[model samples]
Target chain A: MTLLKNIWEWDKRNFERLRRFQLPHRFKQIGFALFLVAFLALLAFRFVNNDATVIKTSLKYILLIGLLIISVSKEKIEDERIVQLRQQSYQVAFVVGVLYSILILPLVNYMADVIFKKESLGFEVNSWEVLFIMLLMQWFIFRMMRKKCS
Target chain B: MKNTLKVERAILNLTQDELAKEIGVSRQTINSIETNRYVPSTVLALKLSELFKKPVNDFFTLEEND
Candidate 1:
């Protein structure tokens, strides 16, 4: 019982410490701007230098990092309800992201192969893509839930 | 959980926004709690109790479903 209690206390303390590290509300806007610039740059680069895989990958990472910043930033009103909704959104997004990567993507690849009458096109879902999907889903669900609650 | 937050606020003639400001929460949070869409944490409950000069039990009650 004492060990369990100590562990609970440690967990609670770390959770509070993590909360303190959240970025201010204004960071969300900065994150959005970064994401937009990276996305547009990626598109322009793709047209200009189609074979620039390294630069394209770097741009994608920048976009994902921007999203991560947005996800970690605090809301204007960072109350208990908002925290709860954020946690719920993360949970839902994780489950959906895993399912999409493991099931939906594979199924779509299979369908495409059958339609084209070709061998496996070596289509694979990367971790970055899964992270992007999860972040997008989290943002969408969080906004929807906030709207509903309001 | 069911709460008499709406009733207490009404009795105090306080708008949701006003009460929310007093409790350091967003207006939507007060609205959600009153509408049964959200259950506040104990800290928030105690803050409300303190502000309203009532025991937590007076304003909050557990529903059978809860």
Candidate 2:
């Protein structure tokens, strides 16, 4: 019985360590994910020397799809605090997305005029900006409203 | 977030998860309510009160903003 109790306590400690879902846990996962992306991006940039456009574009598209999948987890949100945070986050993201569009509009037109020589889908790189803004807004709302609800 | 949930659960000695199952919510939701993380809607408040064998007012009290 004593041995069993000690084993149970050890197992509980292990579980807690593995399943730590606080802010630092989420941040660590995100940091690791970003590092993986940067490593892959560097590899893609280095390896495909010839016919750069085809391979680089494909790599960018892959990253685009990956980012979309990660951000699309918005569909699975279930917590009320998270939902409340999302509501305010969306409000800010909308404003920030619009502002981002405005800031990039001139650059986009210039890129079209000088580089691509016409309108193109280069603006899709705004995915990270949108995700960042959304997360920032969510955090802001969570911080602002968390106390009130409590 | 203020609720007569403590009184209701106390009468039966039902755990938060058991009460949540009875009301068709996740345990986290019941915990949230008990800890004042979220306030239930009028319908849900009424349901809880009914389950607790109490009046809605007895189960839920309103503050100025809430």
Candidate 3:
């Protein structure tokens, strides 16, 4: 039992140490700005060139890359409080995303029924949109929690 | 949980930045602790205790609700 406790303590310490190698706060800030600009530019281009298949194909990738950079960005102080907030954010994102998806099932069905005026409109929710929503939600929640916690 | 971090820092004549640098954390972390907005981890609490030359309990105390 003592040996097991010691091993657990050692592992916990190692895990905490590993959390310190996050991107520098300034780098994260710059990345956030750059990615936001790139994403918005791509989005505007897609709007202007609505029929461009290449734009349509690349939009999701751009959004994903932007979201990834934003999510990985560290706060000004990457302390234990911020780490706790990050964990909370991921948990909140997953649970809320699943619930939101479930709720959207009926929403899509209703939209198909009313708007399309067809028995089976065959509407599909874009998987990329779901992922984007999840990441956005996590980032928002993490920011709020970090502010509240710290 | 509540802490006497501000008082302890005063006793040692250490600024928040200095204490934070000594412990390898940002100054905002020390400010948060001083303001009772954030709780330090066990490792951090121990480090603070070591720096202050006192027991951890001397700086931090559990409230009734805790």
lDDT string for model 3 (A31-93, tens) is 567557767777687668467767656765766776777787787767776777788899999
Clashes of 3: 0
lDDT string, candidate 1, B3-66, tens digits = 9998999999999999999999999999999998998999999999999999999999988987
By summed lDDT, the worst window of 10 consecutive residues in model 1 chain A runs over: A117-126
C-alpha lDDT (0 to 100) for residue B7 of candidate 3 = 96
Q: How many residue pairs clash in each candidate?
A: 0, 0, 0
Q: Quick one: ranking by DockQ, best first?
A: 1, 3, 2
CAPRI level of candidate 1: medium
Residues A1-150 of candidate 1 have per-residue lDDT tens digits of 999999999999999998678999999999999899998998899679568888788899999989988899999989999999999999999999999998988888899889997788455888888999999999889999999987
For lDDT, candidate 2 versus 3, the one ahead is: 3
- Cα lDDT tens digits for candidate 2, A65-130: 444333324322245445555466567667766776666655665677787567565445566555
**Candidates 1 and 3: which is better by DockQ?**
1
What is the alpha-carbon interface RMSD for each candidate? 0.7, 4.1, 2.1
Q: What tens-digit string does per-residue lDDT give for candidate 3 at B1-66?
A: 989999999999999999999998878788889998888899999999899999999989999999
Query: Where does model 3 sit among the CAPRI classes?
Result: acceptable
What's model 3's lDDT at B56?
99
- Kindly report the docking quality category of candidate 2: incorrect
True contacts kept of 3: 0.65
